[model samples]
Target: MQAIVVIILILALLLVIFTLQNAMDITINVFFWEIKDAPLVIVLLTCLLLGYLIASFYFFPKLWKLKREYKQMIKFNSELKELHELNHKNDRKPVDDNSDPEGIELDDDDNDGSTFFKD
Candidate 1:
């Protein structure tokens, strides 16, 4: 896993370097816009900004709701685990080794007190 991540990081760095070496001009018909002397980094940054803007306008509210619900579910599950532990602790009872049949033994100080059933 670590090797794969390092390889991916190296590849991404090489891509960034390659892109940064090529500065280009672009034109947009939607806004009748023309950009001059724009580096690839700048173009990428603009695209990222526009993408975020579109997402915020059309998709962000629903994504935010889902994130909030995920957090709530995690909290509920943690609380449930605590509650289950507490219930299990309260449900345990003391036992006596003398109640066992042959071929079985129990330590006096053992608090678990689990009974072994014989067939």
Candidate 2:
């Protein structure tokens, strides 16, 4: 913040110096309209301000769309993370090593493809 203020002060000083040095009167003509005895500093500053406004207006919609997309992506990412966490929590079921869920059991000594049914 202090750095920004210092930079702004320096720019203001430079602008004051420039305005004092270029305090000349000039005439401007556009089509049939004529502007007489206009200060060079004011005209230049006005042109700069107009250019800044024009550029800002030209890019405002694109900037707004990018912000909207960024917010939507953040929301989607959070939802996906929550869904993954929910699935991970629900998948923590205990397993039984000794008992099989199916009734059929395989015999280790027999090489034949035969399954024994539990009694």
Please provide, for model 2 over 1-119, each residue's C-alpha lDDT reduced to its tens digit, 9 standing for 90 to 100. 99999999999999999999999999999899999999999999999999999999999999999999999999999999999999899788777686656946654674665647532
Q: Pick the candidate with the highest TM-score.
A: 2
lDDT tens per residue, model 1, 12-118: 99878867676665544446666555566677777889999997888878988999999999999999999999999979877666676764765665466654552
Q: Model 2 misses residue 53 by how many Å?
A: 0.2
Span of ten consecutive residues with least summed lDDT in model 1:
110-119
Q: What is the lDDT of candidate 1?
A: 0.78
Candidate 2 deviant stretches above 4 angstroms: 92-119
In candidate 2, which residue pairs get closer than 3 Å at backbone N, Cα or C atoms, i.e. clash? none
Q: What is candidate 1's CA lDDT for residue 37?
A: 56
Cα distance off (Å), candidate 1, residue 74: 1.8
